[model samples]
Target chain A: MLSPGATIGVLGAGQLARMLALAAARLGFKTHVFAPSADEPAFDVCAARTIAAYDDPDALDAFARAVDVVTYEFENVPAATAEFLDARRPVRPNPRALALTQDRLVEKEFVQGLGVETAPFADVPDAGALARAVAKLGRPSILKTRRLGYDGKGQVAIRGGGDLGALFRALGGAPCILEGFIDFVKEVSVVAARGVDGEFHAYDISENQHENHILAETRAPAAILPETAVRAKEIARRIAEAEDYVGVLAVELFLVKSGRSERLIVNEIAPRVHNSGHWTLDGALTSQFEQHVRAIAGWPLGSTARLGRVTMRNLIGDDAERWPEIAAEDGACLHLYGKREIRAGRKMGHVTRIELE
Target chain B: MLSPGATIGVLGAGQLARMLALAAARLGFKTHVFAPSADEPAFDVCAARTIAAYDDPDALDAFARAVDVVTYEFENVPAATAEFLDARRPVRPNPRALALTQDRLVEKEFVQGLGVETAPFADVPDAGALARAVAKLGRPSILKTRRLGYDGKGQVAIRGGGDLGALFRALGGAPCILEGFIDFVKEVSVVAARGVDGEFHAYDISENQHENHILAETRAPAAILPETAVRAKEIARRIAEAEDYVGVLAVELFLVKSGRSERLIVNEIAPRVHNSGHWTLDGALTSQFEQHVRAIAGWPLGSTARLGRVTMRNLIGDDAERWPEIAAEDGACLHLYGKREIRAGRKMGHVTRIELE
Candidate 1:
């Protein structure tokens, strides 16, 4: 078992890593953040930090020697980098999980193979393949890159008679997945954690709303049937148990209304803490970041009890400038990523409110 | 009003400061920790930090110029130090509050003058005064220095028929307070905060236990009569309004039960967050540290709702070695002060557990 004062090394020094470092400190563990960019956000809150390329062997070696276990904030950790650190120290959520999540096609197949419902999807490698996949999936489909896509980036929409060949080239002709759009009433997610000892814990379901494919707001106890919520959690539990997941895993689902019946179709899996789970930091007994730290440290899972009726709103870019008004609001919990600039589409911070029933 | 990106300057870099920095971050405010120690716990988790002696004028001036307001983790801030920073920027809880709290004699008189019940106390400057005070107060009393006393330090107990002159001379001939001991059943505290606009909020009373004169454990919703609890909160409110305090304040009280009747006597007052209030970090709707940050930053006070029956235990010195075991507890929340030594009597960390009724 990991003891207090032991260091946990984190790859990717962003806001997620910054929060993870803070959580680790609360549990009596220190954090060492490693990122390629020197101006990474997580550096400000870590006991130690290294600004060097992921391929820099010397820096990686030093980091490996310092921490008891290594974890990543983002799933895009290079396989070689994971292997390098895995050879020197233990890596939680393992490199295989990273490989499975880094590729969109593999992630879709993996979810479907687990007997979990996923939207109709087909792999498209070329213009011919795109046309054939579109024909199979029908119109109003989303074509997303197979790798390294986030925040509505590297995605194209094929509405009815849109050109297939130009669309393929527009996406750089990379391996992609064509997903049949679900006419869903809302989007929901289950943020859960699995420990090394096979223990499972899930927070309450959150109903999410998006603007331009980026999360806008998340409210807890998703407006859905209790059975549907149970199924959502079951899907996440099966996936984590199947993979022997040792950290927080978030499963995003599309809630489809079908003639007085409701069904949840898996949209994607985030093998780390997700944006939808940010509300738990102030609204639940155990926060997702702290849960992740507990899992990797091989500790007991915390209570996932929702404290009250909770809602979280993302403060994107310039939206965070309204902090003064929000701070003046009664019982509003505001959080900000300590990034220096206000770039468009960047997640600046969030505010959570818990109403007593 | 302070904006989202405003920086807060905090003096005294301990676990309290670390928690304050984290709380400020949640409100989209940055914390700049200034302390004389190079390896303070707060340094690892703040947006910025400065290392310099409290008496260094240049460092103080630079620190004051960089932040919107100044606050401290402890009440030992010297009058000159607070004045230097106050000249350059706004200092919350003001220097007068600090000066009042740093001296036990002043604090007792201040509380008593407000029509609040306090242990009978008399100032003793020399052997003659000591003899006279002892003759009036009688045996079974406590002799404490007038200034710089905390956690059982700088004080000695005078049993029945003890030497008054020798004890007085041993106290360095400094001004002292000889307080008649009260027959109390339990010790409790009310941790509250006052916003800059004069709004006040208080957490529920916490029953405190001491080991070797150092705090060992605190349980919230202290076992006391309903009226006694109400009086405890009322006393705190009156004190806050009287001082115009704009930060967290802890009022320690003695619960006297001499039959069916129970009464509360004010024992002491802390101008900052108290150890007895640490359970709020994981057990209340708003932590005392976060509440202090909000109040000093001129934000609305959060609800002081306790999550459950909570117990907080301090890990002093070698007791911190049990962190591994503590982490393995299903519902225990652990916090470590990043001090590098295991010296006896040092507070290393604490663990809080919230039990649902």
Candidate 2:
């Protein structure tokens, strides 16, 4: 087991990394945040920071030597960067999990191959394949890039009137995947952790809402049936075991209701802490960030029991200006990202309101 | 009112400041830790740090200009240093509070002046005064230095057999106060905060246990009667108002029971976060550290409602080596100060166990 003074190296210095570093500190571990941007939010709270590109070998080597273990806040960590760090130190949740989640097609295939249900998807490498995949998936489908896509970026929806070749050309002809949209009742996620010894623990399911393709809010316990919640956790456990994943991973699922039966279809798998699981920070016995740190450090996972009925609202853009008002609210836990600018659509902070049962 | 992105200048670089900085970061405030030690624990997590002597005017000037407000983790902050910062920026809890709490004689006088009960105390300016004070207070009384005393340091008990002159000389003949020891049922503390507007709030009282004069453990709600709890809170409120305190302050009290009535005698005042209130970090709606940040920022006080029945145990010296075991225990929240060395009696970290009620 990793000792108290062990340092954990984190990639992608954003709000997630910031929270992770705070959690690491709580667990008696120091954090070294490495990111390309100098204006990283995580740098403000971490013990050490390296403002360098992920692909810089010398920087990566030094960081690996400095830290006992490596983890990332974002899934899109470069494959070569993961390998380089893995060679020097244990890269938690493993590089295979990162490689699987970085590509839309591969992630879906991997999930489905594990006997888990996922939205029907097909690879669309070029216009010819796009035309074929569009016919197979039908209308109102999402054509997302196989790599480097997030928050409604690098993707286009195919509706009634849109030329297949033109739509393909608009995306810069990047390797893509076409997925059929699922008619779902609600979006839910399972935030779980797997230890090196294969001990799996999942928090109460979280029901999520999105605005403009970005997470807007989350509510814990998900308002889902107990059996469905159990099934969601099982799905998460199966995936973690299959990938030999260590650290917290969030599986976004679409809860579909058909007559008297409700089923779930996997939407996406985040190889790191997900926005939907932000509610866990205040609503659960142990936060997802802390759980991730424990898993990466080879420590025993903490309790994932829900604290109460909780709602987490993201403070996007200028919403952070209301921080004072939010802080004044009873039972409201406001967490700001410490970002200097409040640009439109930026995730500036989050507020969690918890009501004990 | 201080805005979200403002910087908070903290004096002292111990675990209390480390936890305070962590709490400030949660509220989007950057912390600038100013202390005399380069290897201070708070330096690891703060946004900026300055190492300089407390009496250094140039360093103080630069630090005061950089932060929006000033606060300290320890009450022993030099009166001159507090004055220096107070002149440049507002010092929450104010310099008057520092002056009052730094000297035991002044602290008792201030508390008694507020219609609060305190142990009978007499000033001992010299050996002659010490002998007179001891004669008045009687045997088994405590002769404590008026300033710079903590964790059982700078104090000696006058038992049945001891040379009064030798005891006086042992403390370097410093200005001292002889306090008659009270026969008490329990040692309890009220950790509270007062905002700039004079709005006061107090957490549930915590019953504390000390080993070798250093806090060992604390349990919240104090096992006191409901009426006594109300009375304790009232005492805290009165003291905060009297001092015009604008941050978290801890009032240690001796719960003395007589027949059918229970009364309290003020022990000492910590003009900053107290170790006894550490349970609030995981047990209350808002932690004492966060409450301190809120109060100093001129923000609304957070809810002080306890989340559960909580116990906080300080991990002193080599006790921190049990971090792995503590982290594995269910419902235990481990927090470690990033100190490398584990000298005997040094506080390394703390663990809080909360049982939801």
DockQ of each: 0.53, 0.78
Report the C-alpha lDDT of model 2 over B249-341, residue by residue, as the tens digit. Answer: 999999999997999999988999989999988888899999999999999999998988999999999898888788889878888888889
Against the reference, the lDDT scores of all candidates come to: 0.88, 0.92
Categorize the docking of model 1: medium
Error of 2 at B267 (Å): 0.3
Candidate 2 lDDT, A22-51, residue by residue in tens: 898887788999999988789989889998
TM-score of chain A as modeled in candidate 2: 0.98
- Candidate 1 error regions (>4 Å): A257-261, B169-173, B257-262
TM-score of chain B of each: 0.97, 0.99
Write down the worst ten-residue block by lDDT for model 1 chain B: B323-332
- Could you tell me the TM-score of candidate 2? 0.99
Clashing pairs for model 2 are: none
- Per-residue CA lDDT of model 1 for A95-185, tens digit only, reads 8888888988998899889988889999998789998998898999999999999989999999977679999889998989899989999
Q: Highest DockQ: give the candidate number.
A: 2
